[model samples]
Target: MEEELISKKELLELKGISYGTLYRWKRKQLIPDEWFIKRSVPSGQETFFPRDLILERVDSILNSKEETSLDDLAKVLYGSPVEMNITLNELVERKMISDAARSAAEPFITGPTDYYGALTVFSIGREIDSGDISLDDAGTMIRSMAAAEDREMLRQGVTRLYRKQGVTFCAIISDASKVSMDVSSKLVLEISMPRAAAAFKAKLLPNKGEEEDE
Candidate 1:
C-alpha cells in the first residue's frame, strides 16, 4: 500500500515550523531518513514525508521538548538502547519478552541480560512458535550466527531478520520498510513499521493524552 504522503511545504504550514527547523531535526536524526521521500512532480522534484508517522513524531518532539533532552528523546523515539539492562522478570512483566521465550532462552544467556539479548530470545521464540524452526535448531542457529565478527550488526539499534530459501540471517537496519536489493531481479518483501511492530507484539509509547483517561 502506498504511504499517505504530504509535501514539505504542506507539513511546514500545518506544523507552523520553518524549513530550517525541519532540516535541523533531520540532521539530528529525529526523523528517519527514509521518510524524507523525493518524488518527481509535473513542476519539479519535491520532498514529501509519511503523513501520519511524521506528524505524530513531530508532535511528540514539540510536546516533550521542554521537559526531555533531545538526546533522550531520540532514544525514546527510536527505541531504548540495547545497552540498557533489564532482568528476565522485568522483561516478562513488561511484556518485552515472552515467558516461553525466557524459558527457552535461559540456557543461552550468560551473566546479566540486556535488551538486545532479550530481543534475540524473543525473535527465536517467534520462529519456534511458527514451526519454521525448532527450539534446538534455533539455538544452534543463534550460536553460529552470533559467532560472526559482524554479530554486533544483529542487535545494534534496530535489527531485521532476513529469511530466504530456508536460510535466515539477521542484520541491523535503518529503514524497516525498504529492502536493499542491488539487482532488480532479486525478490523483496516490504513490511510496514506498524504491521511489523504489531506482529512482534511490541508496545509503542503513548503520545500525550493519547491514552484513555482512567
Candidate 2:
C-alpha cells in the first residue's frame, strides 16, 4: 500500500515550524533525505513526506530538542550502532516484543541477543501479532536474516517475505527500491530494519526527562 503523504506547506503549517528550521533539521540528518519526497506539481514541484512518520518525527525532535543536541538526536533517530545485550525475556518485559513473537524466536536464540538480532525478532513478532504472517513463515524470515553475512545490510536493509507454491521465502535487500521478485512469487511483507531499529531504540532508551514530571 502506498504511504499517505503530506505536502511541505501543510507540514510546516501543521507543525508550526519555519522552512529554515525544517531544512536545518534535514541538514543535521535528524530527518532522512528519503522522507523529503519531491514530485512535480501543477505549479512546478513540491516536497511531501510520509504523513505519520514525519509528524511523529517532528514531535520527537521538538520535544527533545531542548535537552538533546541535534547531532546526538540524529544518531539516536538514525539508528547509529549502539551496544545492547538483552535477553528474550527482557525484550517482552520491556514491551518490545509480544509473547507470541518471543515464543517463535526462543528456540532459535542460543544466547544473549544484540540490538539487530532483537530488532529482527521484534519485526517477526510484530507481523505475527498483526496476523500479517504466520509464526512458521516468521521462522523462515528469521533464518534468512540471521544467515545474512552483511550486518550493515541487515542494519539498514529491508526484509521482504514472499510465498510461492505454498513455500515461504525471505530476502534482505539494501532498500525497498532493490526489491525484485519472480512472477510466480507474491510479496507478503516488507519491513524496514532501520525504521524498526530507530523505533526500538526510542522505546528502549527514551530521552532524559521524557518520563519525568514537567
Candidate 3:
C-alpha cells in the first residue's frame, strides 16, 4: 500500500496544532522520529508525516490532556512498560510481585482484565513490596478501584497517591468514577462519577480517519 503523507503545514492547520507543540511532542518521543519525514518539495525541504499514524497520535495526546499527564499519555501512546499487559499469574511468575500481592489484587478485578487493569494491580503490588502500603491497605485501594460504576470509568481516570510524613492517601477520580466509600479514614478511596455521558468517554480508543475526514 502507498503510504499516505501529510505536509507539516497541512497537518498543523488540519489538526489545529501549533508547530512548537508538534516539535515538542517529537522531542518527548510522543511522536516517533521516523514519522517526521523530511523530503525536498517544490517549495523547499519540509517536514511531513505518515498521515494516519501522526493524526491518531495527535488525537490521543489531545484527548489525554485532562485525563492524565503528558508523560503518561506518551507511555500509553508508545506502548511503554506501564502500558504493557501481563496476566495475574504472569505478574507473579515474572517476579514483578509476590504471590501475596496478587492475592491482594484479586478483589479489584471485576471481570476479565486488560493492560490498564494489570498495571493497576502491578502498581499496588509494588507499593506493598516497597513498604509504602500494607497488604490490607493495598486491598483497600484495589477495592476502591473495583467499586467504580463500570470498567470504562475505572480504566479512564487519574489515580492520585499522596504521602505526607508517615501518612499515605490514594484516590481514583475518573469522568465516570462515581461511587461511595469511607473518606473519613486516612486512606480515602472513591470514584467521582461523570455528570454526563460525554465526560466518561475513553479518549485512547482509536479515532480512525478523524483527521482525514476533516
Query: Clash number for every model?
Result: 0, 0, 2
TM-score of each model, in listed order: 0.57, 0.87, 0.41
Worst 10-residue stretch by lDDT in candidate 2? 205-214
Q: How many residue-pair clashes does candidate 1 contain?
A: 0
lDDT digits (tens) for residues 1-214 of candidate 2:
7999999999999989999999999999889898999989999999999898889889889988887899878876774765567788978887889999888887777588886788889878878998998889888888887678887777788899988999989989996775557999988898988777766656654633432343
Residue 161 shift from truth in candidate 3, angstroms: 46
Regions of candidate 1 where Cα sits further than 4 Å from its true position: 1-6, 13-16, 51-53, 75-82, 119-148, 155-214
Residue 170's C-alpha lDDT in candidate 2?
A: 91
Q: Which digits, one per residue and each the tens of the lDDT, describe model 1 over residues 109-189?
A: 755665445555556666666666555556654554334355344443244445556555444455555656433232222
> Which is the better candidate, 1 or 2, if ranked by TM-score?
2
Candidate with best lDDT: 2
Which stretches of candidate 3 lie above 4 Å from their native place?
83-214
Score candidate 1 by TM-score against the native. Answer: 0.57
Q: How many Å off is the CA of 67 in candidate 1?
A: 1.8
